[model samples]
Target: MYRDLTIGEKGKDVAQLQKGLRSLGWPTGADPSGTFGSGTAAAVRRMYAAMGYAAPLTASAVTPSANAASDAAGVGEGGEQPGSDIEMGRSSATPQPTEPESTVMLPVSEAVFVPSLPARVVSVPVQVGDTVKGPVITLARGDMTLTGFLDPSEQRLIRTGMKAEILAEATGVHTTATVDSVGAVVTPGSGADKTASDSSAVTPQNGSAYVPVKIKSSGRWDKKYADQDVRITITAAATSGAVTAVPEAAVSAGADARTTVTVVLTLNA
Candidate 1:
């Protein structure tokens, strides 16, 4: 009275066979299409093997009784039943707690990062298992620049666009650079007015006045020089043509607050 589903067959009976295979965790290629194909034939052989049947199926024909056996194995075509953990090859008599399925999703903006320009990561402030409270990573780009601090008197002479000489003591490389910028504000106790090429270098101390200055090389700078101490000499001023000079001792301030230079004249007899 029950019909057998075989390859090349179509209609609702073939669809039932496909559903039965899927219920037993043997996928029949796709959703029940009501037409038996090569995929269905392969799944039929696998199903027969799982059921401990040594005899090969006839032309991949699935009998109605076999569909009933598959349904009883674990889950029905409709849904999963209580204590029906057939995928594990076992079943429990007592009903177990069913955990609800959970899914987590994040917004596109929070999930992706788009930087304004091309950059390279300099450092990561956190490690694995550390909670992120502030900045996670630092990025840098473009040419490298040198940062140095100067005393108030020296700062007054250094200005942006001035030519500077750079010397790396470690490598003995001398290079020409230009003053990129000069900080207008002076912080106090800023330790010794030293040059720093990285973040770990000497920092400003409390109550010391020091102005920060930035200098950039005129040409390509080697990355190996980064973070190393370097000497910077900025040409505060320059002049051309002949000029008058005098000794330090001869130059003096008069009582009237006027500068005067002592001149020595030799008489020829």
Candidate 2:
């Protein structure tokens, strides 16, 4: 599935999606966030039309879509999801993740540099074909950021405080992540727009203009990705710390029976 595919921190998935549609003349008008959303779906539908396909599920905005809210889901169980042209033709010989060909209008790749071993020298081992995971910025230190443009025919979810997933290429092992931040603005991808920050090497940056949330990691979160294909899922959720763990199958039983899982708390004091 390789959902995580951004190169560095702040990878622009939405913009890339929108830009693809724009290239096809649909125009999503959304700057990429490297995060998939409503606008991205619309873009995919537009692409499908250009490819001569009938109104696809995504484009059928009238009826509620099952995977409507989801973005960049990985290949399913060693096979592509049915009805998705992009995955159906995936080459088994060189099996790997690929965006749905029928959905994506155009593809865009940004050039990036990977840090060399010993954390001293830096090199650009992977490029276009490679993928990335969450916050490529934190790992691709010293690397620059690339922002994408938008087209006119796009939509957005625009729910502030709602969670989102990120898929980025990593430099090391594992390429997946959870939501670490949320949007404060409600953008409909009809040309969505949106920030601030500082620290006294530790304190906080007193802003001069409108301020943006500035959160400093406690250094506990993952940060190994540098230049690899990664997948992120912001949709799935659990309580902080996942205090109560349960198998996926158990979830339904737990929900239907109103089973209350205990949240054990231990104080070291």
Candidate 3:
């Protein structure tokens, strides 16, 4: 029984997704703007791999037809038989290979900085002499918003009131503060060439529909720096314990995707 089969960001937006999902049978009440929410993910997980959309979390992305069903449940470590490879040469001294290991699950996130918004500087909202808050962030708008989303599995890694160091864009000076809000409203849509880090490419669909975050606090800005932009850094949560973890820096594609590992080793010359 396939429930949620979302043809999301790669397709429509969240509301449209929800509508389409409902039309397709899994009525998540999700807005099809292509947002990746709890309702949509759960539905997809149950309905996906079985329908061949993707594979389940495992030791590798490259699945094995002969071993997949056997490995479906957790394989023991070192589950290989060296003798099986030899043709009629049964060696009593061969060692067995290890079984597949369990995978660790972590919440991944994409970020948006103040400069990344399609809103543009549009006259820096604050002036140098004006008072401002410490925590500052900007949301993207448009087709990208609906397509760009943070998996709900990653929600636990981010939180409100987390401490964030802030920096002004023009002056290159920075300050410190704590987070005040986490938007429950996710942006929908994606671009062929855009990424979480590309500021200039994040233009919104409706133009004025971006949800830039306004930090709430009290501090006087150096008047000369009022027109500058701000940026914030948030901490990512940890999901350690025999699970797979690929550092974001190691991935070449802006780490825009995730997958299981088949082999990990170092060649010692």
Candidate 4:
């Protein structure tokens, strides 16, 4: 028997499995990339339905008719005899309102199924023209996150309000972001260590811990830059300020602890 297919698996085995499903008229969602993912799992379920197997049941799968029948069954077992006036009245009573169709209906993609336990797979081992059963691929889904590390000094200079300038070295495109947090505990090292920094300035040869920094950006960022090494600049520092100077001898401290500067004006006749 061929080994079971699962998510995170790749190579000729996955491609072979995908090709087999396609021959059976199942859609794998995309061209066989040799990587089993959610799209592949969906195609497997389609195959199950094709072989007269129903998709696993879920709370959302209960149909309106099934619910009505269940309710009727409960009433029938309440000691009501057939054709009795009480039973007749109950039957003729106003029907209970059901949830709006829009609220109860689920999209085909969102439907969750629970197939029989111990899972079933194709009885016949995967072959040139044989079909298989059970999940061909497992799936894991979650939101993406961006994590980075900063030097202790750099971390102290950063705060939540600081705007981050992200530069893509390949495309020279820029994206704007804001600091979300600065980690409390220092980590021994981070992804940035393995990567070459934009600047060749001196760096600590001995491994130095870094504070984790999380960044939040508005709108969408090009997925092409994901995991690709990029440069981040903290642009929230004071770039400009007005300056005035007074001689120290002309300044005095008041009782209130505030500094006082006396400017003498001489009037000439």
For this target, which candidate reaches the highest TM-score against the unseen true structure? 1
Cα RMSD to native, each candidate? 19.9, 30.2, 31.8, 22.2
Candidate 2 per-residue C-alpha lDDT over 133-231 given as tens digits, one digit per residue, 9 for 90 to 100: 532333323322111111212114222243433345444344223223332332332222321111111111232122122222233334443332344
Q: Candidate 3: which stretches are off by over 4 Å?
A: 1-157, 186-212, 222-225, 236-245, 249-266
* Lowest lDDT 10-residue stretch of candidate 4: 102-111
Local distance difference test scores for all models: 0.63, 0.36, 0.43, 0.58
Descending-lDDT candidate ranking: 1, 4, 3, 2
Error of 2 at 128 (Å): 28
Model 3 agreement with the true structure over 110-196: per-residue lDDT tens digits = 112222223322233556676776523343342121122234455565566666666667778876655555444334353322333
TM-score of 4: 0.34
Candidate 4: C-alpha lDDT: 0.58
Among all candidates shown, the one with the greatest lDDT = 1
User: Which candidate model has the greater lDDT, 1 or 3?
Assistant: 1
Where model 2 places Cα greater than 4 Å from the true spot, the runs are 4-14, 30-32, 54-269
Total backbone clashes of candidate 3, pairs 3 or more residues apart or in separate chains? 40
* TM-score of candidate 1 relative to the true fold: 0.36
- For model 4, residues 226-257, the per-residue Cα lDDT tens digits are 54566778864563677666888999998999
User: Candidate 1: which stretches are off by over 4 Å?
Assistant: 1-139, 188-207, 238-269
lDDT of 2 at 243: 78
Instruction: Please provide TM-scores, in order, for all candidate models, with all chains considered together.
Output: 0.36, 0.18, 0.27, 0.34
